[model samples]
Target: MSRGTIYNKDTFLTNVANQLGRKRQTSSVSLPKWKKSPQYDVFSELSEDALLDEFVKQCEAIHTEVIVTEMKEIQKVCEQVIHDLGGESLVYWEDPRFIKYGIDNVLEKKRETGMDIYEWSSTKGTFNIEKAERANIGLTFSDVTLAESGTVVLFSDKGKGRSVSLLPKTYMAIIPKSTLVPRMTQATDIIHERIKAGEKPPSCINFISGPSNSADIELRLVVGVHGPVRVTYVVIEDE
Candidate 1:
């Protein structure tokens, strides 16, 4: 079977249809309209400011630090986070958004000050993963932020390694205010719309909430077992 092609899908379906003595239905069906769509209704009345407030509240509940600041102060806030986290080395995605949002300045200044910094690069191959493993911090921008769950959605690609957020001791996300949504429902809708418009969706979409935590080990809550121990959200209020 070819890649992306289902192995014997038509034959399997036809066999099942023959057993039922019916023809295979190939027409599309319309979905029933629901009376109540609570998914869309939740936080529907909230203004942008109210959404940010809710996002911050949710972040606090999850033990993630939320630093709300304007665009002009982004570099300063990033520097403060690095200092507070004792980040001697950093790894981040090669996203242009970092440069657009002033995070590039932090990388440049920190590198000048003798702190090691690595950007995810396809050409670097496993070298990116190796550096990310030893790096103290990993930084990236959230494609869509879920205000209700305090989740930062990342669209990872060749230039954006999923391990950039997964392998670091501390994970930081720059969340644009405009990317804030009420919940996962809105986030999926955005992705669905992109697909409907003939756009190629990201290969990997990660919804990270705070830091990694699990209660699977004897029902005891453990942090950083699967990923970063500390998570920080730097919200650009003016964006």
Candidate 2:
């Protein structure tokens, strides 16, 4: 049969109409415009110094060692933290200059401390998952915002895979203070902008408010159930 004759003869439309029955008309409600509210500053009350102080206190309260230093001094801190933790150090960076500088600084520190330093290569994506888990510490950058509930948003595409941050026993995220956001909604705005610009979201987007924690079982509090047991945020003040 001809295609048009076959379709008309089959009663397909009738069957579909019967199955669907009558369509209903519904009214649509417009969502409120994205607006910044005064409450956005609630989390911002913690000044840069105050935030660092509170961050250290929080880490110590959970028995995690935190080393606060300028971004330029990160290599030194990384070497020290790795030696002190007694675990092999793994460094991941996407920028070539920073990577070279980091590797050189780490090597120099390694010479003094006898700690092993390994450069993470992006070509080997899955190769480092296990190593990061066994690592004592993981370091990476943050696509920061000042209005994001004092939170840091880390994209796995930034070179530090999500596993590096999530599976490790301790995680140190380096976010510049200028990137600090006042609320979570502002972060959403940033995400929307990227999406609108036709950018794929990263493999993972971690909105880490604090360390991994839970109060799910019988109201007894627990920490690090699904991710790292310890998380230390280093706010890089100088841009």
Best model number under TM-score: 1
- Model 1 pairs in collision: none
lDDT string for model 1 (14-39, tens) is 89998999998788888799998888
Tell me model 2's lDDT, rounded to 2 decimals: 0.61
Stretches of candidate 2 off by over 4 Å are 1-68, 71-75, 91-97, 100-104, 111-116, 145-150, 198-200
Scored by CA lDDT, what does every candidate get? 0.91, 0.61
Model 1: lowest-lDDT 10 consecutive positions: 1-10
**Displacement of the residue 110 alpha carbon in candidate 2, Å:** 3.0
TM-score of each: 0.91, 0.65
Model 1 scores a C-alpha lDDT of 0.91
